[model samples]
Target: MKKIVTLLCLGILLVNCSNNDDEMDIENSTEIVVDETQEMGTDMYVGNFVSLAHPTSGVVSVSDDMSRLDFKNFKTDNGPKLLVYLTTDTDATEYVNLGDLKGIEGDYNYTIPDGTDIGKYKLVNIWCVDFSVSFGYAELKK
Candidate 1:
């Protein structure tokens, strides 16, 4: 009887499993919406890149929840490996590495680390790991 009950419970959980709709909704919101932003009280940290080693154009927006960092209209010359960062230093010497960038074109979001102190990180950098080069960077401000 114990074995049968255990199997039945596991089967029920598997049947109920579905795509996590809440997380999907946050990821899908790339463009900042006025009503949503007002309700959440999080104005997206918007910025644009200046030429460093590569020429790029785009807008990077971070949701006030810090759950999503979306890059829109983003373009950059291909490189070995690219990563995103929130940094206090322009050289990216002192920083928090967000995650591996999803792509160079189109819009995408990178998850911010839990308990990140957004106030300290004033710059966003797209860094090349293999070559230790900063392709471009943007400042985050109101």
Candidate 2:
């Protein structure tokens, strides 16, 4: 009976699973949005990355205009199917996919979708989409 119930629950979850892309109303543009400064923005909200499933270190900042995510001194272990996400929590519930990570180590930028409510997201996750795990995350703050 226990095994049957577990399988039933798993099946229900599978049926409800949907691709995150469909939930997002973002543009498909790949253009980098960082301004001439090429550095953190003046009125940015920032956070420091913490290792979770892998060794990760960096600083993540959201531009004051909420137009971009800037990763500075960012370092993380390379993994297959890694993605960047702005999530409501470290667990990635209620989030927006920024897209595939640009590199495993470097300063880079990811453009945020126009009209996204940046205030709703609390953490930036280095997520491994294939494995359903977070390699690291940064909790954002003013």
Candidate 3:
């Protein structure tokens, strides 16, 4: 009887230990994926700049009064690099690259320089070199 009782206790202890190990393994295996889905139907503005789902009517004027291009549901391991461009009309396929705007984090702004030409412009694309992802055609009213 003593031997049987000892064996039963040992079995219970082993089962408990195995359960604990399994729980630890499950916890470690789980990972969270950020920026998996793009969130549409959101608009943001900084100073005179405005971003909508579709382009606005008339020429979207932009100037030094604008600060940063706002983004929704943007996630990254490090940060994103923005490429700003200017275009005259919608049918115009060619875009003039303004420059590369860096240091973009979540809900952050990129400063618009004083000499930036005031006209219809767009965010064009935001590149995340660290994550290897890019958001394209993010139109911005200058």
What's the lDDT of the predicted structure labeled candidate 1? 0.75
Better of 1 and 2 by TM-score: 2
| Candidate 2 structure quality by residue, lDDT tens digits, 28-83 | 32323335354455746889999999999999988878888999999999999999
How many clashes (backbone atoms < 3 Å, residues ≥3 apart in a chain or on different chains) does model 1 have?
A: 0
The segments of candidate 1 whose C-alpha lies over 4 angstroms from its true place after superposition are 1-42
Residue pairs with colliding backbones in model 3 are 62-142
Candidate 2 CA-lDDT value: 0.84
Q: Indicate the residue-level lDDT of 96 in model 2.
A: 92
Predicted candidate 1 versus true structure: per-residue lDDT over 35-65, tens digit per residue:
5455324656778876688886787777867
Best by TM-score: 2
Which of 1 and 2 is the better model by lDDT?
A: 2
| Deviation of model 1 at 78, angstroms | 0.6
Taking all chains together, the TM-score of candidate 2 against the true structure is: 0.70
The TM-score values for the models, in the order shown, are 0.67, 0.70, 0.30
**lDDT per residue, candidate 3, 32-87, as tens digits?**
33342232212332222233322212112222345434443333223445454443
Q: How badly does each model clash, as a count of residue pairs?
A: 0, 0, 1
Candidate numbers sorted by lDDT from highest down: 2, 1, 3
Best by lDDT: 2
How does model 1 score by TM-score? 0.67
